[model samples]
Target chain A: MREVFQQSLREVQERLVKIAELVEDAIENATSAFGNSDVAIAEKVIDDVEEIEALAAELDLHAIDILARQQPVASDLRLVVGALRMSASLERMADLAQHIAQLARYRYPESAIPKGLTKTFVRMAALDVEMAAKLVELLRTQELDVVAEIRDLDDDLDELHAKVFEKVLSDKLANNPTGVVDATLASRYHERFGDHAVSVAKQMQFFLSGSLD
Target chain B: MREVFQQSLREVQERLVKIAELVEDAIENATSAFGNSDVAIAEKVIDDVEEIEALAAELDLHAIDILARQQPVASDLRLVVGALRMSASLERMADLAQHIAQLARYRYPESAIPKGLTKTFVRMAALDVEMAAKLVELLRTQELDVVAEIRDLDDDLDELHAKVFEKVLSDKLANNPTGVVDATLASRYHERFGDHAVSVAKQMQFFLSGSLD
Candidate 1:
């Protein structure tokens, strides 16, 4: 019975890593799409969202099955429960990526964001993609350093988000109302993508260290 | 053992309902503060957020105990897992409410939103408070009809959110750039509050019906 439980637990972990990788891909593609104003890449990200959702659902059921059949306790039980949350968090990150893609798609040939502000958004996207890669590492290793790095990346994203707004509201640059709203919402999407990554990292850290903080 | 498990489960349910009620209160106070531009009420809501976070953590620990010690299966297992997710969704809802309060507090002595759009925001706040009340009921009842009602409320909120953006971008209205951004984010917070409520209702519905749709 213990062997079966361990086997199922390994399966859950492996699937979780796979989901993390997919989320990384989604972020990378979404950012590239946004930066390049490439509608095709954006469409691709949107198209691939269903697979991530399907995987999340499958992982959830597998976790529940382990809980029911193996009746894991202590660290093992925490692993199972935490998997459910991690999958949900990753799925949400994927959805945010898709939202970024949709923004690119909405504007098509014209960038969703204004030209003057594109450099900041491009930097934000790069930072986010780097953070997503770190998330894949954190999931696989469960290292505290990776978690800290993700937190720092989120801080940078937050600062970038603020800069985006600062530029938009500055009198030196003038964008129409539509540009203002789109830039505001897009910057928020990128920043929030990092926030979700941080939340997942915190959850994993809590599970491994037995500390909720 | 069975009686004790059921009793603990009951405690978990009671605490969850209490959290729901607190979230409802947070929404009420936050909106009142926003509508009246009352910094005091907004500060009260912000200060009280830790209580809700602490309650959510306690509920999570309690639910974990029920799972680890009781080894609940099938329906009981579903209830335990669902409680974890439901508590999370509720905690996030409360955070959104606190964010609303923070926005009000940030722009104290003046509304965060523009004067031209205050009436629309007032209406949105009222709808959000109504939706929060329904969330309390749904948590207590787990009724399918309540889930349907929450969905309708979210739709209404989405429409209101769109109206907010529309009004901001309209030619007639003249909001400064800061007003446009604040209104955009505040509308999004209210809309997301409802989205969380709907997600909680859907989780409960799935638990009762054993269908993931």
Candidate 2:
């Protein structure tokens, strides 16, 4: 019976890893799509959001079933709870990415970003991808060492996020006022995506150590 | 031993209630302090941030102690976990309020808001106060019915928040560009504070019935 429960739990974890990977790529592709106004990529992001949502639901149902059947105790209980919370965080990240893609359909069809400004956004995306990838790797391999590293990597994202805003409001949009508002909000989305990805990492930490704060 | 664990949990609950009340007031005071340039009010808001942090640490210790002493199962375990997550949310709400107060200090001694748009910020403050008060009431009582109502109340805040930004960018800054940025970010702060307060209400929902999606 315990083996059955563990198998179901592993299934949920595997789906969660897939969800995280999809979210990571969706945001990265959507980030590029918006930067370059690629409609095909934007539409793909919206489609991915549905898949991410469905995966989240499946993970939840499976988690609930395992809980009801096994009545997970101690560390097992924490793992299931963390799986639920982490999937929710990933689902929201997917939604935020889709929201960014939708902004491509807003007015000002040909607003070009200043040279090299997309670099900051790309870095932010990379940070999110790194965090998501690290979380999945940690969960799948059950590597405790990676847990401490996740927090350290978070600082680089914070630095990049701040630099993105500073560069946006100062150098990039000093005189180009037409789509500055949209660009400003774009910066907000990037930073928030990074935050939510870090949240996934933190949830991974909780699953491992059960010291969530 | 179990009775003592219950007592600690009860004390933590009471402390969380106090923290909620204080946070509600802090959000109100932070915005009022911003709109009015009231240094004293800003100080009060900042002070509450420390208090909330201290309470959060206290609650963390309480959770640990209860788990160690009682080895609680079933509903009792869920209650402790939910409380831990709720207090973390409360601490975050308080931190955001504190940041708003800090922003207020930068806008003071300037009277920077344009003549016509100050009323919009005042309305924002009123919204903040309304939601904050409602959340505190819900936290104190832990009623699911009230939690559902608070969820509905967020729609007004959402509309107001959107309208405030629209007005600000369209013509609200025709005269007072000096304080326009300050007013813009401060209004965002109030809108976000309302969201956080609603989040606390949502956490209360989880504790009440275990359904918050």
Candidate 3:
């Protein structure tokens, strides 16, 4: 019976890592679609989100099942609960990526990003994708060091997000108001993608350490 | 033992309602503060968020405790899990309200909203508060009618949010880029506040029906 419970726990962890990988791929493809106005890629990302959502729902039910059957105690209990939380964070992260893809889809043939701010957005996308990949690693390993790197990448995304706004708001830049709105909102999406990665890392920490801090 | 479990479950519901009320109040005050540039109100809202956070943390642990001890099955299990999800949603709702307050506090004495968009924002705030209040009632009653109202209100908010962007991007309206950014992001915040309320309502429905649809 103990072995059965342990196997279930391990399977839960494995599925979580798989979900993280799916989310990571979505972010990378979505950002690329955003930068290049690649409608095909953006459409694929949007279509793939359904699979991510289904996986998240499945993971959630599986975690709850573990809680019901194993009636896990102490650290084991925390791990199951943390699985639920991490599933939620990853689900929201995927939604953010979908939003980015939708923008790319909405403005097909014409990039949502303006010319002057394109480089900054590209950099933001790179940082966000890097963070998402790290999230996959952290989920697989539950290492604290990986969490720090993901947070640092989030900080970089925030800085690039701010720079996008700076260029749009700069007197020298000649961005129209519509383009400015698109850039601001898209930057926010990338920045929020990083934020969710950081949040998931924190959930992972809480699972391992059993500490809210 | 059953009575003890029942009492614990009721306490969790009460606390969840309390968090909802706090979040509702935060949205109301945050919006008013945003409109009037009232630093005192904004500051108070920001400070009050800490209490809301503490209450949410307490509720989560209480639910987890019920899970560990009672090991509730069937509907009881669903109730506890629902409590966890609702607590998380409400906590996030409060954070959104706090973000709105911070924007107001950051731009105190000088309103974050521009002149032409102020009325639209005020409407969005009114709708958001109404939705938050409905959420409180829905949490208490779990009635489907309240959920519909909340969804309708969210639709209203989404419309207003689009209008804010339209005006900012229009050739007729003259908005400074900074003010535009503020208005755009602030409106997004209010719209998202409505979205979270709708999500919680869905969670409530799921709890009662055991169906995700």
Candidate 2 lDDT by residue in tens digits, B77-142: 656655666676777778778877887776577554555667776776777777778777886777
- TM-score of chain A taken by itself, candidate 1: 0.96
User: What are the chain B TM-scores of all models?
Assistant: 0.96, 0.88, 0.96
Ranking by lDDT: 1, 3, 2
lDDT of each residue in A59-173, candidate 1, tens digit only: 9999999888888887788889999998888998899999999888888888887768878988998998898899889888878788889998999899999899888787633
True contacts kept of each: 0.48, 0.00, 0.50
For A1-213, candidate 2 gives per-residue lDDT tens digits of: 777877887887788878878887888777777777777788889998999999897887676566555666677766776676677678878987887787665533664344456777667667666776776687677777776676667778778766754655564444443344455556666666767767777777777777765
Off by over 4 Å in 2: A50-74, A112-116, A144-153, A168-178, A206-213, B1-12, B39-44, B57-81, B106-116, B171-184, B203-213
Candidate models: Cα lDDT each: 0.87, 0.70, 0.86
**Which rank order by TM-score, best down to worst?**
1, 3, 2
Best by TM-score: 1
DockQ value for model 2? 0.19
How many residue pairs clash in all the candidates, one count each? 0, 0, 0
Better of 1 and 3 by TM-score: 1
> Chain A of candidate 3 scores what in TM-score?
0.96
Task: Identify the runs in model 1 with alpha carbons over 4 angstroms from their true place.
Answer: A173-175, B173-175
Every model's Cα RMSD, please? 1.5, 4.0, 1.6
